[model samples]
Target: MADLTTTLCGIRMANPLVLASGVLGTTRAILTRAARAGAGAVTMKSISLEPRDGHPNPTILTFEAGVINAVGYSNPGVEEALAEFADLGDVPSPVIASVVGRNAEEFARVAERMARLPVAAIELPLSCPHTPGYGTLAGQSTPEATREITRAVRAVTAKPIFVKVSPNAQALGEIAAAAEQAGASAITAVNSMGPGMVINIEARRPVLAFKMGGVTGAALRPVALRCVYDIYRTVRIPVIGTGGVATGRHAIEMLMAGATAVGVGSAVAGGGVEVFARIAAEMAEWMDRNGVARVEELIGAAHR
Candidate 1:
């Protein structure tokens, strides 16, 4: 069997397949199932300082190739998350706690609370572009503010921290370098794009209750790949590649382009949990068939 194992920021994942934060990863049961199903690791649903019920009405919808969502970062509060995390047993694999906060204090506080848990990593959900203050901080169009928030979160936890960025920003290289300097162990580029909106022609009204939603799927692959490729060269930290990964071949492409690992979110919504297992198993088989003895060998192997 091919060695599908890969290490990111010092954490060794069973495989590169990861369950990205959102509806599928919100609970321990779901996370445990993902782990069992063969995800190398799982990122918890985005948790915030205070509980948010999120925008009402239709928040999720099927777009042509992937999905458009404006879930509005709804989640149980950190206190409650900590409570739920305490009950997990037989955790199938490493866990990444996804946390979001309004400002530095919330980030620090959430990081500290999660530090007490058994999580292998912490993913700062700084992406939801449609939200007000909280969403933009991670991909803060400005490097200074991004650096400030990263610095604050860094001080509190020694666990590996991955800063998930929004694609809306114009300067990816600058901001990625800033995040690395501010103490992020790794960078996950690029989060969903657009505050793209859809309308119900019949109602002559907007579809989502939030009106605007982030765009994700195959359409985002090029943008995400470019961000990872650029950031990989600009910074010494690892890059968790994402955006439109729906097949084993897509996973290999991201790996070759310098992603130490890749995140699978939107595809799971369409492909189902079996998709996780399929990707891992298929990747392993592809590695062997392609004469790749190890997946790590593919990292940064892109010729141009």
Candidate 2:
């Protein structure tokens, strides 16, 4: 059998696939189901410093490439998430907590709260695009702010910190470098592009309550691959790729682009957690055929 296991930030997962933080990871039942379905790990639905009901109705729309979301980083504050986090009961290999906040202090607060939770890592979402002026704290757009927030969180928590980035920023390289300087253990790039909006012709109105939001789906794979490849070259720390990954080939592409692991978010939204089982089979089969003995060996192996 091929060695699919790859160590990330000192944590060993059964495979390289991780369930991205979002709807599928919010509830106890959903996370439990994903864990059982062979997802190497699962991230929470993004906890914040304070609870937010999120934007009003019509926050998501379906398109050919992916779904546009204006969910607005809604979550039940760190306290409630802590309760849900503790109930996970060790079913998954290591539960990864996804946390987000507006400023550096807020990020630090969320990190400290999650530090008490039963999680192996904290994926800081400092780059949520739909949230207007906020959310881009770690996205490589604002190097100074990214370093400040990352350094603050690193000072408080020992858990692995994975800083996520936004696609809209052209200064992603500087942002990643700053995070490394501030102490981020890994990086996940290209959160969602556009913060796009679709209008209802008859209504002459926006589809989402927030008017615009992040887009994620099959359409975003190429952009995501580029972000991963770029960051992989720019930094020594592992790059955790995410975006429009839906198949075994896409997952393999991310690995070849220098991603230590890939997070399947939109695909999970489209096909359910069973996608993990399917993709795992396909990847393993492809690996066996090529005599690829280990998954980590595939990193940055693009057609050279």
Candidate 3:
């Protein structure tokens, strides 16, 4: 049999499949359920210093290619998150906390508080495309912003930090490299693409209440793969390839693109948490059939 176990910044996982943030990671129960369902690791939804109501209804819309969402950064805030995830003794897989803020100070403060918990790592989503006063809309996608935010968080937590970047940034590789240089332990390449829009045609307005949202699903895979590939070549840190991964073959393609682990988000909406087990099994089967004894061997195979 082929080994699916892998490690990210010293945190070991039974498989390379991770439950991406903001999918079904709304509560501790869901996070635990994802682990029990076969996710090797799980990330909580992005939390801010204060609770947010998020956008109005119709925040999410599904199209033929993928789902576009302007759900905003809705969360119970860090205090509630701390209480919810306080005890991880029962949770089987490692938990990664995803933090977001309006600025470097807020990011650092949130990271400081979240790091006090037992999470295995800290992830900063500095690339959310649809949110105002945060992410790309706030010009946080620049390499300078990446480095500053990463450095701020680094000062507060000794825990490993993973900088989540955007696909829309032209200097995506440079942004990844900046994060690495500023003390990030890993890179989560490519947050959902576009604050894209869909129109009802009949209503003639827009589909989402917010009128725009970040894009995810099959439409994002190729762009995400390319982002991961570029980041890998630019930095020595591990890259968590996120966006549109749905099947074992897609996972394999991400691994070859230089992802230390693959992130699964929108696929869960269609396949449920069981998707993790199915993808892992498929990965193992493919590995065995190809005579690859270890999952690590597949990482960056394309570059080789």
Using all chains and alpha carbons, the TM-scores for the candidates as numbered come to 0.96, 0.95, 0.99
lDDT of each: 0.83, 0.83, 0.94
lDDT digits (tens) for residues 8-54 of candidate 1: 88888989877778848788898998889888888888888788988
Clashing residue pairs in all predictions, respectively, total: 0, 1, 0
Residue-wise C-alpha lDDT for candidate 2, range 1-304, written one tens digit per residue? 7777888899888888888887587777788888789788788888888888888979878887798998877788898887877766856667888877777788889899888887889887777877754685234257787888888899889889999887676788888898888899999876888778899899999989999888888877898999888888888998889989888888999999999898888887778779988888888989999999999789888725
Q: Give, for candidate 2, the lowest lDDT window spanning 10 residues.
A: 132-141
**Which candidate gets the maximum lDDT versus the true structure?**
3
**Residues 30-134, candidate 3, lDDT per residue (tens digit)?**
899999999999999999999999999898878898889999999999999999989887789999999999999999999999999999999999999988999
Clashes of 2: 1
Alpha carbon deviation, residue 303, candidate 2 (Å) = 8.2
Candidate 3: TM-score? 0.99
lDDT of 2 at 45: 86
